[model samples]
Target: MIRIVSLLLVGLLLSCDEDVLPKPNSFLRLEYEKATYKSFDDKEYPFSFQYSKDAKVIEKKKYWLDIYYPNLNATLVLSYMHVKGNLMFLLKDAEKLTFKHMIKADDIQAVPYENTQSKVYGKIFEVYGNAATQIQFHATDSVSNFMTGALYFYAKPNYDSIMPAVHYLKKDIVRLMETIEWKKEEYF
Candidate 1:
């Protein structure tokens, strides 16, 4: 009886030697394929630009388009407006749209872009944190054309989870801003 009790005590003591710990939370690892770009030139639209081939462009209206990324579950919403003496208002509206996310955004960085030769001037707004839109930009010819784009994901705005996708699409946005060309000026 004594030997059995000693063995049971030893077993209990050994079992308590280490405090069991819950495993650390594991994060999902996401990987995406390299992006290939293609030019989008339509005679109907005032501007033309390049976009990722992985995306499908859907024309919403005469001047609006939705660039859908099926793999990333995101969309780049593009709207082209005729700048008829209301360039300031158009630009102000674009900036207003970006700042609307300020409540949820941790930071908003405005990066200016100017291509004097191409006559494409714009500002790209990078919104950091779990905001509704991760990126927003506007390109204009300062004469007759204005274009604004916003990047949105289908999933809930979890900045960390969607950061990889945001980074990928951001390159596409920059490319679009860089390659945008205004066909001609048709002032009203």
Candidate 2:
């Protein structure tokens, strides 16, 4: 009887050592660098606004620029085109650009933004899921200057992984929209 009891105790101990139960899923805790913004205004440029100091402004060509976030592996592309008389076409092009990610995106939500005081009116698109560009917007004076911005990450479009960075930059974009001032002289 004592031998049977010992065997039972040993079995219990072995079972405990084996750890047969599955471990719960866990995710890495990701923390991103804090952001601080500074005003961005160039006499040559038609508009002025604030942007994250963490990002570098790269001018591809005159009036065409990119806000690059190296640490976050992202870039906000700013495309400038003369409206001339094709405001509808410009608006449509911006919409098409935002929706291009629909094949990979779970959803795209447009949050309307209008700063009547600044004369910047546009729609900000928040894209969910694994899309190439997660955010985009267009600001126009509805005459000569039409500018569109799109936020794209360098890495693969894994929405879950980059959400925090996206959230942080979203605010910077909002600030940019809020502060945009179109130069009457710069307009063509």
Candidate 3:
């Protein structure tokens, strides 16, 4: 009787099996350090603004610069063009360049900026999706100076993986536009 009762208890304990459950999908959380800004005032350019201290500014040529974010693997290209009495044309070209991404982009929203005191007027484009470039903008005093900037990621344009970086840099871009005031063109 003792042997039979012990065997039955062992069998009952072994039969109490839990069912295997599937887990929900997991996502990779990438965190970046908080950004700090500093004045980017260089005599080489007609305008100056604040940029993230986290990025390295590379001067490609006179009035042409690249703000590179090493940790995010992205670069902001600032290319300057003389207005030459064609402000409308230049504005059209900038819009066209950004629109080219519409094929791959989910949507594009334009945010207009005007600083009457600084005499700066421009539009910042926020692009959504896996497009090659995410943000683009044009800042001009609307006379002698016309400058356009575009943000590109060195890594493939995977929007999901790069969304955090995009949002982080968006603030920097807004700061840049806010502080980008035109200087009196130095006449030689």
Per-model TM against the reference: 0.86, 0.87, 0.86
TM-score of 1: 0.86
lDDT of 1 by residue, 1-188 (tens): 99999999999988896788999999888787887899999887778899999999999998899999998899999998987899999999999999999999999999999999999999999999999999999999998899999999999999998998898899999999999989866523
Expressed as tens digits, the lDDT of each residue in 1-188 for candidate 2 is 99999999998887785557788899887776666889888888878788998989999998999999888889999998877789999999899988988999999999998877777789999999999988899998877778899999989889999898889889889888888888875455
Cα distance off (Å), candidate 1, residue 26: 2.1
RMSD of every candidate to native, in Å, equals 2.6, 3.0, 3.9
- Give the alpha-carbon lDDT of every model: 0.93, 0.88, 0.90
Q: Considering only N, C-alpha and C atoms within 3 Å, which residue pairs clash in candidate 2? A: none
Give per-residue lDDT, candidate 2, residue 176. 84
Q: Top lDDT: which candidate number?
A: 1
**Candidate 1 Cα lDDT to native:** 0.93
Candidate 1: count the clashes. Answer: 0
* Full-model lDDT, candidate 3: 0.90
Task: Put down candidate 3 lDDT per residue, 46-130, tens digits, no spaces.
Answer: 7888899999999998888999998888999999887788999999999999999999999999999999998889999999999
Error of 1 at 67 (Å): 0.6
